[model samples]
Each structure stands twice: as structure tokens, then as C-alpha cells.
Target: MDNTDTPSSARQSLLDATEALIYAGGINATGMDAIVKASGVARKTIYRHFATKDALVAQALRERDARWMRWFSEETCRAEPGPARLLASFDALSSWFATPGFRGCAFINAAGETGDPADPIRIVAREHKASLRAFLLQLAIEAYIADADALAGAWLILIDGAISVALVTGDLQAARRAQAMARCLLPTFFAPTTKELP
Candidate 1:
């Protein structure tokens, strides 16, 4: 019942190890022994930190969500908040794709493996995607794009699709292709007001 190590370090150690192992080997494949080995925390210590494996996994994912969203926001929203920032999302994605051990999206991967929509992990996955969609919508709204909702939805699809395709095909250009496709949609969806006409 005693996690022995300081609460913060013990909990964070489990979270760190669980995130890496789950992302690399998946929920079913990554066992407690592996986590114990990677974390160097005892079994009882893990139980003291988390009641169950699912609890540990869910917490790890929540931490991962915070970390991933922060990094993604810094990458995509660092520039001016308009069309440029919106388009820069794809560029950010491209850079991420090029990174070592890039495995597409953790949320999507987790969701695909989850059967129960009511599961905690599934909820976290949905939360992650919703955050992304909301960010895209905000950008579209700021850019005064017509039908911001629809454009944001489309961008989410394109982004997720590009990630999946890139993971499967090992083609880093998938992000660029998706971006090009997104670019074409801009003029198509954009409606200029008569007052703004040249």
C-alpha cells in the first residue's frame, strides 16, 4: 500500500513510463511488469499511486494530453492568429511527422483500439480531438472565414487523415498534400462582401 517514493516522483514516474510504453506498445501489449521495469517503481508502489492499470493509463493519457496540446498550441498558434496560423498548423504537423518515433496521433490510436465509447480512455481521446477542432474553429472565426464551423470540421478531417496516411505510407508530404487541399478550399469557401469589393 506504500508507494515508498515521494508521492509526486512516484506518480510522475509511473505516468512517464506508462505514457511511453502505451504509446509504443499499446494498452493491451504494455503490461505492468514493463511499467515497473521502465519506471523502476515497485508493484505495490504503482498500486499506491494508481488503483488499477486502467487508472494509470487514463492518468498517463491526461498528462500526455496536456503536454501534447501545449506543444501543438505553441507550434501552431505562435504566429499571427489568422489564416497564416491556420495554415501553419499543417506545417507544424509536417515537422511533427518528421520527428523520430512519430506514430501519428495517440488519441486516434487509442480510440481505434477502444471498443467502449463510455470508457475513460475513449472519453480522453474525444476530449483531445474536440480541443483540436475547437482551436481550428477559433482560427477560422478570427480569419472571418465564411462557414467557420464547416471549415474547421474539414480541417480536422484533413489533419487526422494526413496523420493516418503519413503513418501508413511513411510519406512526410502527406501533411503538405493535405495543406494544399486545405488551401484550395479557402477560396472556394470564402465569400467577399460587396462593400469590400475592389
Candidate 2:
């Protein structure tokens, strides 16, 4: 048997193909036949791995969420620590926006595709957002921002708005604008003094 014929390989191929197609178009636009053709996996093999299309989509999204978070973290970590790192997130986003075939955020697209609140795709989308918020909250805490939770929430709004606006207007500068706003807002939360002055 060929190395690519393994169950794991087949599953991963399906997921990779599905993610690519979904990113290019949308969940509704991509069909099982397309996935089968793109992945080069037999229909029975696809069903063996995923009982349904929704199941396959959910798995693909989960994989995407993990991959995106890893990439974001790596990009953000490249900046100086503390507040600088927080602002660097925007720079990272700007780079992402500039990438070829940039088509808004995958999570946002998935959420908008499904109207059902309890849908698996919607659930994964929400989870992705929550994870991003948590990452921002961690950054806020590291920066010693007062009301870290609120700061994180504000950051989330700015990030989401910037992404949406960039997609609609094709303006990559949205990230820089959002970063400037974040910088202006950061002074409101100063790190607590740990040592008493003489």
C-alpha cells in the first residue's frame, strides 16, 4: 500500500482539501464531490473517517483554529515583550491581510454561513473567537493594564472591526489604525507600582 493510503493520511488530505476549498469559496459552495476530487480519496474512505459532511467541516475548522492560533502566537511573540507585543499584533494582522488570496477571517466567514446557533461550524467559530479573546486578555494582563478584561474586550472589538473593514475596503492600513487606537487607549491602564519610593 502507498504511504498516502493510510487512514491518517487520507483523513488529513480530506481536511486539507476541505479547508482550502472552504477558504476559497464557502461551506455551502463546496460539496462532498469536490472534496473527494480534491483530496483524491474514495467516497467510502471519506465516509469512513467522517460520518457526515458537517462532521468533516467541524474537524477541518478545528484544525484551522489550532493552526491559526499557532501562527498568530508565533507572529506576536516576535515583537518585544510587554505592551509592544500587544501592538505588534496589529502589525502581524497587517501582514496576514497582505497575504495573497486574503479573504477575511475563516471563523467570521464560518459564523456568517450558518444561521443555526447550535450548529457545529458556528460552535467552532465561537470557540475560535473566544480563544483569540483569551490570548488578548493574556497580553493585557502581561502589560499590567487596569481592567485587563475590559482592555481585552476593547482589543477584540478593534481587531474584529479592522479585519471586517479591511476585507470590505481592501485597506490593509486598518490594522495600523487599530494599533494606533490601542496605543492611545493603553495609557489609561498603568502597571501597579511594586516598590515604594523613598
Residue 187, model 2, lDDT: 69
Model 1: residue 110 alpha-carbon error in angstroms: 0.7
Q: Model 1, 108-170: lDDT tens per residue?
A: 988888899999889999999899899889888887778899989999999999999999899
Model 2, position 171, has a per-residue lDDT of: 93
Backbone clash numbers for all candidates listed: 0, 0
Name the lDDT value of residue 148 in candidate 1: 90
lDDT for each of the candidates?
0.86, 0.88
Give the clashing pairs for model 1: none
List clashing residue pairs in candidate 2. Answer: none
Candidate 2 is scored at a TM of 0.93
Taking the tens digit of each residue's C-alpha lDDT, what string does model 2 give over 131-186? 99999999878767768898888889999999999998999899999999988877
